[model samples]
Target chain A: MSLPTLLEVVNLKKTFVRRSGSFLKPKKTDVYAVNNVSFSIEKGEILGIIGESGCGKTTTVRMIMRLMNESNGKILFNGQNLCGLSDEKTTKVRKDMQMIFQDPYDTLNPGMRIVDILMEPLHAHKPNMTKEEKYQKVKETTEAIELIPAEDFLNRFPHQLSGGQRQRIAIARAVILEPSFIAADEPTSMLDVSVRAGILNLLLDLREKMGLTMLFITHDLSTASYMCDRIAVMYQGSIVEIGETQKIIDFPTHPYTKALVSVVKDLNSFIENRETMILDGEVDSTKKTLGCAFVSRCPHQEAVCHNVVPSLEQIDKVQSVACHCFGSSKMGISERSGALV
Target chain B: MGKTVLSVENLSTFYKTDKGISRAVENVSFTVEEGEILGLIGESGCGKSTVAQSILRLIEYPGKVVKGKVFLHEKELISASEADLYDIRWSEISVIPQSAMNALNPVHRIGEQIMEAILIHEHVSKKEALDRTKVLLELVGIDRERWKSYPHEFSGGMKQRVAIAMALACYPKMIISDESTTGLDVLTQSQVIALLKDLQRKMNLSIILISHDLPMVTSISDKIAIMYAGKLVEWASTDDILHDARHPYSRALLDATPDLINRDKKIVSIPGTVPNLVNIKSCCRFHTRCPFAFERCKVEEPELKEVKPGHFAACFLEEENHELTYTS
Candidate 1:
């Protein structure tokens, strides 16, 4: 039998209460942000959750971390049902599952020094540690992230540091207890374009050194391929495609995935145009429509596309795709599931 | 052939502070050919924005144009009086700055704002200016009927288009877009870029597009200049710069950008942050982070030399005389 999964999600869903219409009666509208989403993370595996800003990538991670309660479905972490946990147990679980947020400047507290910011996680979960022990641990963790010369940085505040430094502190804080899993949500977007590569390499190095499992969230497919072993492409709160990173990139099955894969500007190619399948329209976070969210902009859309929501099917031996038309994989060595029954 | 619309020579801008003068741009010289799209590219603090502002004489005091000359249609702009500068500002050269969301007046209708700009630069009657304003809106792909709508009613991309239309009210010969598509997503970016390209071709307008996106710049611009710590490190045709970039920094930038063709290839981002531009350094600005740094790079800064036909780079490794500088 296969080894047990570290994180297993089943039929997960989230709906928010909206300020209802006129004096007839106030009604609660369901947003369906994360609608019937289900996935799992294997032991020490970097599973990439790729999607646009409003595709519910963040919400899925938030639900897994127990930051927000799921409207429905089960969330199992480390073979334990996290959704059914008491408030106290959930708090304990948070110590083991940390997240590295997008904006480095906004995440760290401006009022606190680097030392205090790094020590906050430890003080919160393990309050029994002595003050001297806390200081030593902070030094060790900061050094582990290659932040360099711990004493010089300890006295400096977050504002005094650069974007790269602040992010290092964010990483150091997250791994202080050495969390089993990290949910890095667009960690390098706010940084300078040139400095981004080093950050990615650091993450790569740390993963190998610590054997840390990560749930990498990013809109960039190339970055996902670089960092993750497997990836799940999210679209309008549902995973449209999931497979091995190389298999997915080489042979993307879903229309959305193909569009994303095609849009990237490669320095390696000399061809004038590589089928520019530009995805139309801005990603509106407030969309509460039924059926497929991308239907309004999808090019191959038929009349039925507007009426019926597509479901994920086993498209090939290794990959799963959620689309109505699963044709042959012209992209590379793979085959798409045939037309719907 | 389109006429040479704008020319800038030995342009140096500095930000004066208590610590020292931050030499943002040093001895930068480039000419924008008429109807040609030139991209000024670099990471943050590279002085790309400063170069744009200096050319426009929009660099407010404390951050002054310490050296160099700028010319509009070959007419000197460096020593041009404030009044003369005003005449050239929108009537000849226009700029689409980043903060259009807050730059436009909230109380005023979009049509009135365009008309006001027209009235200030050119002597036109109220009705005449209003008609022209609507046409200008239509030219930028916005509907004439929506001219009466407020800026808030429009989306981010539409607001930017309105800003572009407003800048073009006087039909300026040159336009500078400072990171206009910086924050927008890929789809919106390409659309805006396409619109700008269309406008450039139709109006024969000389456009200076400044941004940090290498692929986007290389895809659109006829020529590009890579800047670092306010120093221009590389200049070449778009084809040469992106495909066969000789400069270390340019290659690093290309390497850092995610490879769309080869998804398997990892992006090894350039190590180290951009050096702080507190005071001007004699050595090459990018040497601290440049992987190909040598002893000479650390001691003396190299001038931008012609390495290939129609290309220039401030690198010590490339041959000094390659006979390709004047193709620009």
Candidate 2:
């Protein structure tokens, strides 16, 4: 039996109209920053959205957080449509959803003390709570995030603490309210490798303790595989592949996912006959395409991929891939299915 | 390995601060041979970049290379005159900085910037420099005609490639790429590393790739040097470092790093932060975070010694016959 769904994003789309050229002749082109992104987070599950820059992973999260209004589609949180909600209702819903930004240096205010930083969310959300209660909650959250001897850190400023501590403070702030869903966007990428593992483990610990559902966003496949139960590979504003972490890494169906999985350098990869696919050209998000988004850099691009956009299709019990070749015999889908069996 | 291209001996750089002197790079010794790629792996503030800057003699006031010698092709660089250093700067050794966006001038054309390096170092005509710039651009997988475009016209990966082109403009014998592929995406980073590897093979150039990325470094570098708290903890061939890392810090780093292939393996982060370098004691720098630290590690500093053939590790545990096993 499966856990209850906490957050479900359905066919969400976000487009930014770019205005270029002279004042007299402005070229207004529709740049689809995010197109038809759909995913859900089960209760107490962590789903990672993995992609490179300009791949719409951030925009998708921003849209889900209601930071940016979506151009189309529905976001059903707890069976309630978040779109077209009033400001007050949206603010109420935001208490259950909290986001952890990418950069810890810019996220936390420099002048604020650790106590003030952690208490800001409570002040905003729980206005009726007593000042003593707020301070007690701050100490408790600080201790929960493993900032031991909480008194030593609560009085200090963000600058006095290290990069890893500042990040822990940031996490304390995010989870201070004990939200059900947390969106962490590359939370550990800014940290060093040694400190990064600590942060990842802390997030896992928080999820276990609070039973919090999480949307983990990162570009590194290794990190995503480690932290996430399910992985979604995004390319130019679309989820090309989404599946269980092991299945996605072991038998990646999409060409982009295959390329992404191939490029990841690990210790064991040195001894293996690694067939690395060095894809040319970067993601061009400005251009609107009727065909597949990854066709420009994909290795297995067929003639039909240029004109027909392939929808996400269920390839197995837990794997879903958006590729035209998956259904047809052009790219050995049967061979992949045979291996899967 | 071919002939020695660059050799750094007992190099120590310290930053003068209000508290005390911060030893950034301490008694570091390494040699880069011709056509060999050396991977310098370390955490932030661990003196990886300090070593690169000290080799180039770019350390300014307040931060000085107080001791040790840097030699390029048997010519001393630490004691070289300003004019001699200026002549050898890009012509003999060049640098691809971490941030390619800021390394390049926004107003100038990419081709003009690359040609500037060539024209300043070599007695070449403007037309010859332009031709050479075009060739360099094409060599790094950028279109020759795009040289006329400004920096903003290119993407992040293209800008990094342009930086690589500028580094190769003078035909320098050695290039120091200090986290050049940091901000780029995975595929783009792989492409950039592949380009550098290809250029190294074709031109017989030596490269010192300084990054915290262990896997990427191990995949490309002939030798790997692991640094911890301004000290060279371990230095060995890529295979040896991968299979037989002796230093506790190196083993901890490899364990800390998440791997895609080994999904079942648990990533254990080293507890505690890196020690402050200011007025540091003569002890193992990684003792605070080392899992196997003992009384000997807290008092005595372990020197980098050859534990095996072509493998060097700085740790007292190697002498104690502590059988270390790394399960990848």
Candidate 3:
């Protein structure tokens, strides 16, 4: 908890304006892809940005990686504004901040061999290095990712590898530069259970061995609980809840977070005891609403919820929730109490 | 006793690729009784989908069902000709495809698609078909007003509901839901699961639910069948499979799954990858990755045998002691 901050995202926002109506006189409506999101990651800490699709988790990571420019706010890496840096300077800083995408097949080039793919980062960052140095780095990294007898896979293309091995190569490519921070957006969602398990263990091992900080983004709460030190539950381009992983799982505060947690299928729970907490509707990410975004689907919604935006309030030392009815009588839990249902 | 709605025995399917024949589904078998939900579980590329496709004779050119007997009630599906199979499909055994969002025709109205499906299978009038389409939409919990809406106009969950409605248009005795909730969000996935459960109860429909998610499958499935590398590794009740899985692959998959409640248990991902399917020589396919694999696993493939009264597993260790030891 006392670790120093490695990356700080301050109110990062990205808006996409689409032109509609007639061509002569078009009307532009702004889609708030990512709006007013703020969080900080400490060194060696795995902070999960958990949310369903189109909740701006991807946009948030994209802006931090500087793949897409933000419309507003700042991303501070070591107390420096990353958004305003020059092209050359940003390219230099990119080595310290790398990203691992969700689909390993799409991220990797099928035409290139595994060796060349892993060596591209080295050649780009340290172009003056000898061929022996680049080859040595690739060999070490390939072995580190458990592609043992690195010679077996060095000359092979991605199509020749399995899903698990392809993902391992992706991890090797991401960490070959030894970035200080990594933004892994659903790195294992496309993988199988056993493969995901291996990748999760490898990431934990890499964090310990390399002292790496991470922002692991996923929609699965169980994965977040297993891998993250702290999780930030996002809804409609905003984080509705943020806390320690276990605390959020055990004592979920926000209504949306409660719905999400309840919906997660517990392996040990019997079917008869399986709680059915259904939300009324899907996420409306394109809407420019004046009130809380989850109001339409929240079971505890009231008149005030439809008119006012709720800011995050600290409930405890490590837990924070952005809900107006967190500790109030407005909750619609008729029979059971609102505490950790 | 409930009647056997669908029974598959000794089913083997192969895909002829340029390199070699890929053993996609080899000697897999299971049964779905009337009003029962059987979950076919496995990781991606483990041939769970192929099993479903093979049962319906839906495999394409390269993929052929070399040997098997797929019985829907008393009728044999594997031996049925194209014309006979056409008459049986959608009327007797329907399928809810994995990607519901892409299943529906983007240009056609939801009602039209459902009506088309009904008209093709049954001899119903246009007015009756339209009325039945409305009923189908209502049965899946989708509003009847949205029947005229195009697939793109509806939400992802709504599209999935439409797919379910299409599957239920002819009231098939058994429905093969191929990863029906795969691409949906958590809340939507739960909603879809709930809707499927509700439909099953109201209509007494038999379902063969296929998914890679163990926990999600356990939620609604009465029986669970685990597949690995195109073979059936374990088959038992949901409780038994979740609590006392005998096969090393099933146990490893269970251990690899991160539980929402049990946060303290360490997840143990099985090392090594699935064996190559091209001309796969197996005593046990999972022998390379299995921690408890011994000398016998290399020489002979273990057949799935009864470990308990109703539970079955294909493991030599289970045959000996009925338990797997977890040691590094």
DockQ winner:
3
Which runs of model 1 end up more than 4 angstroms from their true locations?
Answer: A1-4, A18-32, A127-136, A266-287, A325-341, B1-3, B123-140, B264-266, B319-328
Candidates 1 and 2 compared by lDDT, better number: 2
Tens-place lDDT per residue, model 2, A149-187, is 999999998889988899999999999999999999999
Which candidate model has the greater DockQ, 1 or 2? 2
Instruction: Give the per-prediction TM-score of chain B.
Output: 0.94, 0.97, 0.98
Per-residue alpha-carbon lDDT of candidate 3 for residues A1-341, written as tens digits (9 for 90 to 100): 79889999998889999878898999998998888888899899999999889999999999999999999999999898999788899999999999999998898899999999999999889888899989999999999998899999999999999888998899999999999999999999999898798899899899999999999999999999999999999999999999998888877878777777776744323222334333457566667778899887876777888899999888889988898887776453442243434
Please identify model 3 stretches exceeding 4 Å from their true place: A265-276, A330-340, B321-323
TM-score (chain B) for model 3?
0.98
Better of 1 and 3 by DockQ: 3
Root-mean-square deviation of Cα positions for candidate 3 versus the true structure, in angstroms: 2.5
Candidate 1 C-alpha lDDT tens digits along B1-328: 4567777888998888999988878899887888899999998878999999999888897999989999888688889999998889889988997767876888899999999999999988999999999899888778898889998887777788888998899999899999987776555566677778788888988899999877677777999988888888888888888787878888888878776557656676677777778875689878887766768888898898877777888888775433222121
Query: In candidate 1, what are the lDDT values of residues A218-240, reduced to their tens digit?
Result: 87776787788889999878999
Model 2 C-alpha lDDT versus the unseen true structure: 0.89
TM-score for each candidate, following the candidate numbering: 0.88, 0.95, 0.95
Task: Using DockQ, rank the candidates from best to worst.
Answer: 3, 2, 1
